[model samples]
Structure formats: structure tokens, C-alpha cells
Target: MSAELEGYEQDYAVLTAEITGRIGKVPRLVGDEKKLMILNVEKQLDEARELLEQMDLEVREIPVQSRSMYSNRMRSYKQEMSKLDTDFKRSRIAYSDEVRNELLGDDGNSSESQRAHLLDNTERLERSSRRLQAGYQVAVETEQIGQGILENLSQDREKIQRARERLRETDTNLGKSSRVLTGMLRRIIQNRVLVVILGIFIVFTIIMAIYFSIRRH
Candidate 1:
């Protein structure tokens, strides 16, 4: 399970890093918020897995099928889009120094250019966002399936543990019974020896009394 989970996490990190790679800035999708979300999903998956193991459930990695996997991928793409959106907006807002002074820091001549650029970038960002959202939804659905299986596995593990404990107890009791039987055998042997000695003493005393009585007569 650990191996499976680690594989999932490794792929997730790689996907996020690749998508969010940028110039003069850290990876976006790998940022704290997204990272936390990914981590949380991972934790959930692990818990479910542990429960499954306890139940002796057979688990296997489905390979990029979990929500965290898709989310990690989408997260990277979204981060790249975010950077593009930020750049587009900032560029459209920036104006020539003279233009800035002439119209209260607004460029009327460049207004059309700004609007066109911003609009184009906005559409691209929106499209990317939609794609990411869709991918994220799929990832979430996969995680739900994982959770269900883990839940079922947990029950099986508990049953197995209880059975194992019972078997251990039975074994212990049998060991004690065997010891008791051995002690009884030893005591029986000791008593037989004592009875034989007592019998010999009684016989010797009776023979001496008869011999002494005959001689006196």
C-alpha cells in the first residue's frame, strides 16, 4: 500500500512540477494551497488503504486513476494558465510613460489593443480552467471508488485479527493442559515408589515378631 501510495504521490508531484514550471517564479500548481489539497486527498487514500490492509483486502495500483493523480495534472495546467492570465492582464494594464501622463495614466489610443489582448487571454484562461475543473471532477470520482473499497477491506481485516487472537488463545490453553498431564504422571510415579517402600517395612516387622515369639516359647 505504501508503495502504491508513493507511486501516486510521485506521479502527482512530477505532473504538477512539469505543468507549473515558469520563468522567475516558483511552480504555481505546487503552491501551498494546491499542495495541501493534494496532500489531503492522499491522506484519505492512505487511510482507506490501511483499513483495507487490516481487512486483508487485495489492493493494487490503478495507475493514474485516482483523483489526486488527475488533480495533480490539472493543477499544473491551471497554474500555467494562471501565469499567462496574470501576464496578459498586467501587460494590458501597463502603458507608455507619456501616455500614462497624458490621460490620467490611461492610454486611450492603446485602449482597443489592451481590450483585445485581455479578452483573448481571458478566453484562453477560461478554457483552461474549464478543462482543469473537468479533470478534477474525474479525479474526485476515482477517489470515491478507492474509499469504498478501503472501507470494505477494513472490515475484513478486523475479522481476521479477531480470529487470529482466538487461535492464539486456544494454543496457549492446549499448552497448559499438556503441562498439567505431565505433572500428574510424575506425581503418580513418586507415589508408587513410596507405597512399595511402606509395604517392605510392614513385611519385615511382621517376620521379626513371629520369629521372636517362637523362640520365647
Candidate 2:
């Protein structure tokens, strides 16, 4: 698997474990049917985690030899973006600083033509700065968007783990209850034929009493 993808998987598993371990204690401690809702949530979480893991595996199957290759690529893209952005900002700052210096009458050692030429330089600088700044902003925004997606995936993994823990607790409780109920039912119905015959006899007796009272009246 690709290193980046493996990193993502490890991160997801760790975060998921942490979140579920925190939330999963409630059902285990309480041991109530009311907490059964937690079981449903747990199932949903399990499915989501499975899906995410599968997706990660699928994405990482491309098999790259070096982990740093992708890291280097990402790092280079980010560095380039940062450098460009900084250069644009510095250019803008320099333009303003030059203008301020000139306006303050620091061009005393120069002629009017040279001073006018400074404005020309400033105009070009301003335009160049704006273009570079725009590109830089775009790059930063894209990086932020990518980070946000990673955070979201992590959050999803967390949700699923919590759910799985809850469902497990519920299943344990459910198994216990099922066994108890089965035993109770079996005990109550131990003498099935005798109970049925006794019930029929009592019903017959009641009917006979009712008939005899009516005839005497």
C-alpha cells in the first residue's frame, strides 16, 4: 500500500479507538435495555468504518516504492506555494515602502525624471504583487480544503468506533437476557399436558355451576 494511504489508515484507527473507548463504557456499566439505541448507532459505526477501511485499501493499491516520494511531492507543492505567496507580499510591501520614502522627499540626490520612474516601478510592482498574491491565496485555500477533508474522515471514523462499542455491549446484554428468558419459559411450561388438562377441567366446572343455577331459578 501507498505510504500516504497507510498513514491515513493508522491515523483513522487510532482516533477511532480513542473515541469509542471513551463513549462505550456507558452501556457496559448501565446494562439496560434503554441503552439499546446505542447498539443501532454502534452498528452504523461499524459499517462506516468498514467502508472507510475498504476505500483506503482500494486507494492505496497503486503500490509506490517510496513513501517519501508522495510526501516530497506534497511538500514541494506546499513550499512552492508558500514561496510564491511570500514573494508577492514582500514585493507589495517593498512597493509601499519605496513610495513612502519617495513621498517623504528622500530622492534629494536624484532628478524629477528618476523620481517619476520610481512611480512606474511601483505600478509594475503593484500589478505583479496582486497577481502573485492571488495565486498564493488560491494555493493556501486548496491546502486548507485538503486538510479539512482529512479531518472529516477522521471524525467519521470516530463516530463508527463509538457505535461499534455500544452495539457490542448491547449484544452481550441481549444474549444474557435471551438465555434467562428461555430458561424461565421452559420452567413455566414444564408440565404442558397436565396444565392444559387442569385448565379444561376448571372451565368445565364453572360451566356446570352456571347451568345448574339457571335450571334451579
Best candidate according to TM-score: 2
| Candidate 2 residue lDDT tens string, 1-217 | 5566666556545645543443443323332542453454455445435635453344434333343354344444334433433333333323344445555577544555665676677667667866775686477446555666776898899999999999999999999999999998888788787799999999999999999999999
- What TM-score, to 2 decimals, does candidate 1 have? 0.32
Model 2, poorest ten-residue lDDT window? 86-95
RMSD after Cα superposition, model 1: 14.6
Screening candidate 1 with a backbone cut-off below 3 angstroms (N, C-alpha, C), the clashing residue pairs are 54-157, 55-156, 55-157, 67-139
For each candidate, what TM-score against the reference?
0.32, 0.34
Kindly give the stretch of ten consecutive residues in candidate 1 with the minimal lDDT sum: 19-28
Residues 63-181, candidate 1, lDDT per residue (tens digit)? 33444454444345445444544543343345445545565544366566765787787777767767776786577557767776887799799999999999999999999999999
C-alpha local distance difference test of each model: 0.56, 0.56
Name the regions of candidate 1 deviating beyond 4 angstroms: 1-119, 127-131, 134-142, 145-149, 168-172, 175-183, 186-190, 202-217
